[model samples]
Target chain A: MKAMQGYCGFLGLLVSALLVGFLAVLFTLVWVVHYREGLGWDGGSQEFNWHPVLTVTGFVFIQGLAIIVYRLPWTWKCSKLLMKFIHAGLNTIALILAIISLVAVFDFHNTKNIPNMYSLHSWIGLIAVIFYTSQLLLGFLTFLLPCTPPALRAFIMPIHVYSGLLIFGTVIAAVLTGVTEKLIFTLKNPAYSTLPPEGIFVNTLGILILVFGAVVFWIVTRPQWKRPTEPNAKLLQPNGSTPEGTDYSITGDFGNVDKSDEDGEAAARKRNLKLDEVGQRSTM
Target chain B: MKAMQGYCGFLGLLVSALLVGFLAVLFTLVWVVHYREGLGWDGGSQEFNWHPVLTVTGFVFIQGLAIIVYRLPWTWKCSKLLMKFIHAGLNTIALILAIISLVAVFDFHNTKNIPNMYSLHSWIGLIAVIFYTSQLLLGFLTFLLPCTPPALRAFIMPIHVYSGLLIFGTVIAAVLTGVTEKLIFTLKNPAYSTLPPEGIFVNTLGILILVFGAVVFWIVTRPQWKRPTEPNAKLLQPNGSTPEGTDYSITGDFGNVDKSDEDGEAAARKRNLKLDEVGQRSTM
Candidate 1:
C-alpha cells in the first residue's frame, strides 16, 4: 500500500496548479474579448461583472491553500511513512479544492449563477472561502503548539479530520457548475473558442477539484492531527519517587535508565526506592 | 486591554467595506466616463485595462477574505480573544490593501502598461501578494499540526509568523500611490478623487491581510488537525493493540482513573506487567 511514495498524496496539488495556469489564460482571454468586443460596455451583460471578482479571488485563495496543506511541520516520533504520505495527501486535496473553488467562483461569468443555471456548485463556491480558510487556521495551530492537550485534543483533532472530508466533498460544488457551464456553452453555439479545454472540459474541473481536495484534506489532516508527539511517561515518584512536589516532565525518558532492565532486581532494589514506594502504595 | 473591542474593529471594518464599495463603483464609473468622453474607445488608455482588473480583483480578494474569515469552521479550542481580534484586524487590512493595490493596478486610465507614474506603492502591492500567500500556507500548517515537531519548528514556524507581519506592513503598497495620485490630481485639478492611503499605508492593508490570514490560518487549523483519535492511538501503539487486546482506551481522560477502585494487588500486577512490556510487547 505504501509503495506509491509521492503518488499517494499529490493528487490535489497537481490538479490545482494546472487549473490555475489554465484559468489565468482562459479568464484573461475572455476579459480581453469583452473589452475588445464591448460586450458589457453598455451594462447589457451584468453577469460579466461577476467573472473578474470570482476568478481573481479564487486564484488568490488557491495560493493561500497551497502553502498551508503542503508544508506542515513535523513530529518527533513520526516515521517517514506517515509524515510524507500525510503531507502529500493534504497538498493534493487542498490544491484540488482550490481549483474547483476557483472555477465555481467564475460561475457568474459563464451564467451559472442565474436562477435556472444555479446548481449546488454555485452555493459551494459562494461558501468555499470558509472551508479553505478553516483548513488553513487548523493547520497553523497544529504546526505551532507545544503538544496537543487532551481537552483540546478531544475537540480540535477530530474536527480537522472531519472538516477535511467536507472540504474535499465541497469540491464537487465547483465541478458541477464548471461542467454544466462548459457543456451548455458549447451546445449553445458550436463556435467554441480557440481554448483547448473549450467550454465543456473547463466546466468539469470543478468536481474533479472537489473530489481531489476532499481526499487530500482527509488523508493528511486526519492522521497527523491525531498522532502523538513523544513518549509521555508519568514518573510515579519525585526524582522517580512520588508526585508530591516533583514537576512531571512530559518527556518520558528518565535519565538513560532502560525501562526493560528488570533482571537486576536485587541490586537495583536499593536504587529503586521510588518504584518500591509506588509499588507499596499500590498494594495498599 | 481587551476593552478595545468596543467596535474598534467595527470602525475599521465599516470603513474598509465602504472604501471597497466606493472603489468598485468608481471603477465602473470611470470606464463609463471614458466611453462617454470617447477617450478609451479606440486606444489612448492602455493602463485602463489593469484598472478594471485591479479594482475588480481587489474587491474579490477583500470580499473573499471577509466571507471565509467569518464563516469557516474553527477548531473547538480557538481562543475567543485571538480569533476575534485577528479576524477584525485582517479583514480591515484586506479592505485597505485592496484600495492601496488598486493604485498600482489602476495607476491611470489613459496610461500605458508601464505607466510613467510607477511608484513605491505599486512595487509593494506586487510583493505583498507573495507575503500574503506565504502567511496562508504557514498558518495552515501550524493549526493543522498545533505544536509542530522539533525538526523544522524554529524555521518554518518563524517564517509563517513573519510572513503575516510582512503582509501587515505592506499596506503601503496599495494606498501610497492613491494618495500621491490624488494629491497631484487635487493640486493641479481641484477635482482630486478620494485617493486611498499613500506609500506605506496603501500596502499596509495587504501586508496586514497577509499577516492576519497567516495567523488566523494557524489559529483555526491547529487543534482540529492535531486532535487525537482512537485510530491514531492504535497506530502509534507498537504492539498493535486492537479493542479486545488492550484495556488502555485512548480517551482524553487520561488522569481521571478512579484510583484503581481501591484494588491494589490486581492493579499492581497489571501495571507491573505493563512496565515489563515497554515498547516491544503489550500487557494485553
Candidate 2:
C-alpha cells in the first residue's frame, strides 16, 4: 500500500513536470513565431529566436529529465549500468542543442555588427554552457568508463550531483534574464512595462520554466526516491565509511558478483551485510 | 585528521561564500549610487534602486546564511533549539527586508504611474516572496513552537528544506531578470549592448551572486556536513523504518531524558544503539 501511494505521488509530479515543460516550449514557439518573426538562419533577429526555443527545449527541459532519471521508480528494475547510459545519452543531446543555440545568438550578433557578451544574460549563459560541458565530461569519464577505480568514482559522485543541480539552476537564471532582455528590446511600442499580450504570455512561460525546475529538484533530492542498491552489488566505502543515504552503486561498479536475479531472503541478507560493514567501519 | 580536514573544507567554503556575497552587495551599491541617480523616493527611477539593494543583501545573502546556519561545525556543540531560533531569526530579518524591497518597487510604480507586475521578473519575484513568507510561517509553527507534534515535524522537515532552496533559486532568477531589465532601460546613452563600464560592473555582480549561491548550495547539501544526531536524543522512526542517513533528532524532540553534556562511552553507546535500531528496522 505504501509503495502504491509513492508511485501515485511520483506519477503526479512527473506529469506536472511534463505538462509545465511542454507549455514552456509551446509558449516560446507562439511568442517567437506568431508574435515575432519565425525562426531562421538568415543572420537576422529570426536566427536569434532559435536561442530561446532551443534553450527551453533542450537545456532546461531535457537536462531536467536527465537529472531525475534515476528517481523514476519504473526504471528501478533495470541494471544501473544501463541507466547510466541513458542518463549520459540524454545529457549529451541537451549539450548539442545548447551549443547550437549559442551559435545562433553569436551568428545573429556578428552579422548585425552588434557586440556580444556585454549583458549579464550573455555572461551567465556562457558560463552555464561552459559548466555544463565540464560536468558532462567529468560524469562520462567517472561513471561511464569501466576502467575508472571504484574509490575515485565514489569520491566524485557527490561532487557530480551537486554541480549538476547547480548548473540546472544557473541555466534557469540565464533563461529568465535572456527572456527579459529580449522582451525589453523588442516591445518598445507596447513597452513590456505596459503588459502587452506577448509580455503576459512570455511571463507565463518563465513561471512555467521555474515551476519545472522546482519539480525536478524536488524529485532528485528526495531521500525516499533514491535508487536502491543493486541486489548483489558489493558496497565499497571510499573513506573507510559510507555517508548516510548514499548508494555507492551510483558509481556503476557492481563488483565481481552477478547475482542480479536474486530475490527474497538472499537479497535481504546481502543488504544486511552491507549495513553491518557500514556500522563496523563507522564505529572504528 | 579527517575531522580537521572536514573543518578546513567547511571554513574555506564559508569564507568564499561570504566574500562573493559581500562583493555582490558592493557592486549593486556602486552601480546604483555612482552610475545611476542614487537612492531616493521622489517618484523617480531612483526610488526603484532600493529594490535591488535590499533583495541582494536580505533576500539573497542573509537568507543564504540562514539556510546553512545548522551546518556550522563550531556550532555543532550548541543546542539544536538555540540553532533553530537563530535560523528563524535570520529568515525573519530577510523577510522584513524583502517586504520593504517590494514596497519600494510598488511605491515607485504607483507614484510614476507605471503599470505594476507586468514583466516576467515581477511575476517570479512576487511568487518567490509569497513562497518565502509561507515557508517562514510553516517553519516557525512546526519547529520553533513547543506544541507541535514530533511526527508532524519529522514529516515537514524534508519539504521545508526543499522549498527553502527552491525559493532561493527563484530569488536569483528574479534578480538576474530585474538586472537585465534595468540595464536595458537605463543604459540608453551608450546602450547596454555597447559593453559600457556600468554594464560590465553589474554583469560581474550577477556572476558573484551566482557563485555565492553555488557555494551555499554545496555546503548545505554535503552529507558529511550535516549536524550530527544529538548526543543523548532518542531515535524515533517516523514510518516504521528510518530512511538511511536521516537524523530524526532534527525534529527537535530529544525525549524526556536530557543528557546534553554526556561524554565518552555513554555517547558512543547511544550512537551505536541508534544504528542498531536502524539496522533492525530495515530488515523487518
Candidate 3:
C-alpha cells in the first residue's frame, strides 16, 4: 500500500505540476501574445486581462493543489495542523484572486458601458466565487479560529466539506465556460471553427483545466489514497487531554466520534486539540 | 444513519430530477425553439441538433446518476449483482448516446463541408467521449464478467473508479463549454452580451449542469453516504461459498481483506463467491 500510495502521489504531483505549468503558459499567452494588456484595476481591457490570469493562477491552479494537499506524501510527514494552514491559506488566496478577477470583469464592463452578469459564464462564475468565499469564511471560523466552540464546529463541519468540494467543481465548470465565452467574443478572422493558433491554444488550456480538476478531485476524494496516520499511542484516546486538536471533520467524522466508547471519544478530542495546538504554534 | 441516508438520498433525487428536467428543457430550446432544425444525419444544422440533446441526456445526466448508484439507499437492499447490472446498464445507455452525439457532430460537419475538431469544445468533448467509452468497456470486462480473476479485479478497480468519476466530471465540463460555444456561434441580433432570452436559457442550462455535476460528485464520493450492506448471513463469508461475487472495489476495499487471519481471508472468499453466485442466478 505504501508503494502504491507513493506511486499515486507521484502521479498526482506530476499531473498537478503540468496543470499549473499549463495554466501559467495560458496566462502568458492571454496577456503577452493575444492581449498585451498590463494588469490594473481600471485600465479597461488591460484590467480585464487580470481576470483570467489571476483566476487561473489563484482560483484554478492553487485551489487544485490545495485540494490534493492530503494526497501529497511529503506533506503527510508534517503535522496535520500545518496541512490545514496550507489548505486554508491556499483557499484564502484563491478566493481573493477570484474576487479581484470578478472586480476586473465588472470594471471592464462598467467602463465599456456593458451590462454585468449577462452570460452564463458570469452567472456561474459569480455563484461559484460567492460560495467559495462563504465556505472559506465558515471554515476559518469553525476550524482555524481558536475560539470556535466544539459543538458549533461539529454541526457545521459536514456542510463545510460538501460546499467546499462542490464549489471547487462549480468553479472549474465556470472556468471552462468562461474560456469559451472569451474565445467566442474575441475571435473573428479564422473563426473558432477555423482552428486558428490562438483557438487551439485556448482549447488546449480548457482541456488542461478539465484534466487538472478531475485529477485533483480524484486524489482528494478517494479514501484509499488518504494519508496514513502517524503512530500515536493516545491517537484514539476518548478523553479531551491532548494539547492540540486533530480535526476529523474533513475525514467526515461529523460528531460521530464513537461517543459510546470513552476511548474513541477521547481520541477524537485529542485529534482536534492537537490540530489547534499545531495551528496556534504556527501562527505564533 | 439510516434516517440521514434517507434524507440525503431524497435530496439527491430531487437535484437529479431537476437536472434531467432542466436538460430536457435546454435541449428542446436548442432543437425546437432556437433552431427548429429537427434531428437528422445529413441536413447540416439539422443533423448537428442531436449533439446537445444526446450528450446532455446520455453523457451528462445518465452518467451522473450511474455514478451515484451506491449512494441510492433503495439499491442497498438489493443484491450487489442487481446494483452492478443497473450501474452497467445506465453507463451503456450513456455511452450509446454519447456515440450518437459524436456521430451527429461529425456528420453535420462532413455534410456541410466544414472542418471538424476545430473548437476547444470539440477537442475536449472528443477526448471526454473517447475516455468515457473506454472506461465503460474496461469496467464491464473487469467487473461484470466471470473470467476476470479476483486479483485482477482488485487491481483494476481503483483506476476504474477514478476514471469513471473523472470522465463524468470532464463530460460536464465539455457540456458547459459546448453550450457557450454554441450560443456564441448561433446568436446574432441581441447578441449573447445582450442576454437575449435564448442566451439566458442556454446559460441557465449550463449552470444547472454545473450544479448537477457537483451534487452527484458529492453524493458519490462521501463515504458516510455509502449504503449499508443487506442482512444476508452469507454476505460476510470470507470464503468462496456464495453464488455471486460481491466485489467491493468502489467501496474502497483494497485486496488486504484480513490476510493475516485465515478466518478473515475465508470470509472474504465466501463473500465474493456469493456475489458471483447471485450474479449468475440473475443472469439465468
Candidate 4:
C-alpha cells in the first residue's frame, strides 16, 4: 500500500458535513412529529409532507458521496479497462437523477401556498443550502471522471478542492445563521408556540467551530498538483499511458500533458501499476 | 460577424443571473428598511449595528467573482487571457481578507449585550438564502470553467446550464417562502408590514416566466447525441491524424482554423482575413 500523505484538514470538513446532515435529520424529525399533531409550523399544511422533504434530502445524502470520491486521492487500483468509465457513468447518472428530483421539489414547494417566515419554506431553505453545498462537492468529483486527461484533471482538482471547502464553509455559516433566524423572527413568533433560546454562545460556537474546521480543511485538503515541470511521473493520461517522467521543477511540464490520443502501451502499463498501488491502500 | 447560435442560451443565463443579483440588492435594501426600527413583537435590541451585516455580504460578493471567471467559454479565440486570470486571482485574495473581517465582526455582534433574537444573526439568516443562492450560481459557473475536449465541454455545459436554472429556481422559491415566513407561526394576521401585496404577484410571475423559459430552451436546444454512429462526418482527432469516429453536433464552433496558444502572424492573418470577409457588425 502506498503511503497516505497530507491533508489533516479534511477531518474537520468531513466531520462538519456529517454534523450538518445529522442536524438536518434531527430537525426534520422534530418538525415532522410536531406537524402531524397540528402542533408544529409547516405553514398551514395539515401534516408535514415528509415524503417530499425526505426525498430531496435523501438525494442530498447521495450528493455527499462526492466527498468520499474527491476529498481523498484516486487511490483505487482496478485491472479492468472500462471499469473506471463504468463507475463514473453510474455516479454521473446518480448525480443527475438526484439533482433533477431534488430541484423539482424545490421548485414546486417554493411556489406553494406555504408562508416564508416560519414555514416549510424556511426549513427547505436551510436544506437547499446544504444540498447545494453537497452538489458542488458532487460536481467537483467530475474532474476525476473516467477517461479524462490527467492534465485537465490536475488542472481542475485544486480549484475544485479549495473552492469546495469555501462553499462548505459558506453554507455552514449560512445554516447557523438560519438557526438564529428562527430566533430573531421570534418577534413575529409564527411557527414556534414559544421562542427557543437563541443561545448566543451555542450558536457562535457552532459557527466558529464550523468556520475553523472549514478553513483548516481548505488549507489542508487543498489538492497540490505535482509541480508541472516535474515529469509528472504520477500524472494521469487519457490514452491510459502512464509514463514515468522525472520530477522536473522546470520547463515543459505546464501540468497539461495532452498526450491522450497518442499510442504508448508501455506508458499505459506504468500508469496501470500506479493505479494498483493507490487502489490497494485506499480499500485498506 | 460570427453567426448567432448556442450563445443565446448563455446570454439568457447571463440575464437571469443578473436579475437574481439585482433582486438580492433590492431585497437587502427592503429588509433593512423594513426592520430598521426592529420588529417590535420581540424585545428589540437597544443598540444597533449594521457594519457586520454589510461586511459579510460584501465579502460574499467579492468571492462571487470566481463564478463570473469560471462561466464564459475561453477557447483559444477568447479575449484578454491575462485579465481573466488577474480578475480571478485578485478577487480571491480580497475575498479571503473580507471573510476574516466578517468573522471578527460576527464574533462581536453575536456577543453584544442585546437580545440575540433581534441582533445581526437574524439579518444574516434571513438574507442567507440570497447569498447562498448567489454562491450556487457562482459554483455552477465554475463547473463550466474552460476545459478542452469539446465533447466534455458539451456534456458539462448542459448539466451546468440546466442545473443552474434549477438551483436558481429553488433559491427564488425560497425567497418567496421567506417573504411569508411569518404566516407559519400565526393563523391570525394574514399579512404583516414586511409582506407587501405587490411582491407576491411580481415574484411569482417572474419565477414562472424564468422556469418556462428554461424548460422550453432545454427541450429545443438539446441535440440528438445518443445515436450509436456518426450520422454526420466522422469524429476527427484534434491533430487531424487519428480519428476516434463519433457523430456529434457542433453547436459551439468558434472557427479555430488558425487559433493557437501564442500571439503570432498565422493567427493574426486569419483574423484579418475573417474581418475582411465580413466587415464589422454593430453586434458583438
Tell me, by TM-score, which candidate is best.
2
User: Higher-TM-score candidate among 1 and 3?
Assistant: 3
Model 3 regions lying over 4 Å from their true place: A1-31, A34-42, A76-79, A222-284, B1-31, B34-42, B229-284
**How far does residue A2 in candidate 2 sit from its true spot (Å)?**
1.7
Interface RMSD of each: 19.8, 11.4, 8.3, 14.2
Model 1 lDDT at residue A103: 48
DockQ-based class of model 1: incorrect
What is the lDDT of every predicted structure here?
A: 0.35, 0.76, 0.65, 0.35
C-alpha-based local distance difference test score of model 3? 0.65
lDDT of 4 at B145: 54
Task: Give me the overall lDDT of model 4.
Answer: 0.35
Residues B56-141 of candidate 2 have per-residue lDDT tens digits of: 99999999999889877556667888999899999999999999999999999899888999988999999999999999999988
State how far residue B117 of model 4 sits from its true place (Å). Answer: 9.1
What is the C-alpha lDDT profile of model 4 across A224-283, one tens digit per residue? 212112233334533222321111111111111122311221233344445545566677
TM-score-based ranking:
2, 3, 4, 1
CAPRI quality level assigned to candidate 3 from its DockQ score: acceptable
Q: Fraction of reference contacts reproduced per prediction? A: 0.00, 0.47, 0.41, 0.01
CA displacement after TM-score superposition, residue B284 of candidate 1 (Å): 32
Candidate 2 global lDDT:
0.76
iRMS value of model 3?
8.3
Q: Estimate, for each residue in B1-284, the C-alpha lDDT of model 4 and write its tens digit.
A: 22222344444655665555445444444443453332122222212213222322343333333334333332213333353464446445544544443444345445553233333334334344444445444533543255444455433443343343233333333233333332322224444323444344333333332333333222222221011122122234544321211111111111110111112223333443344334334233
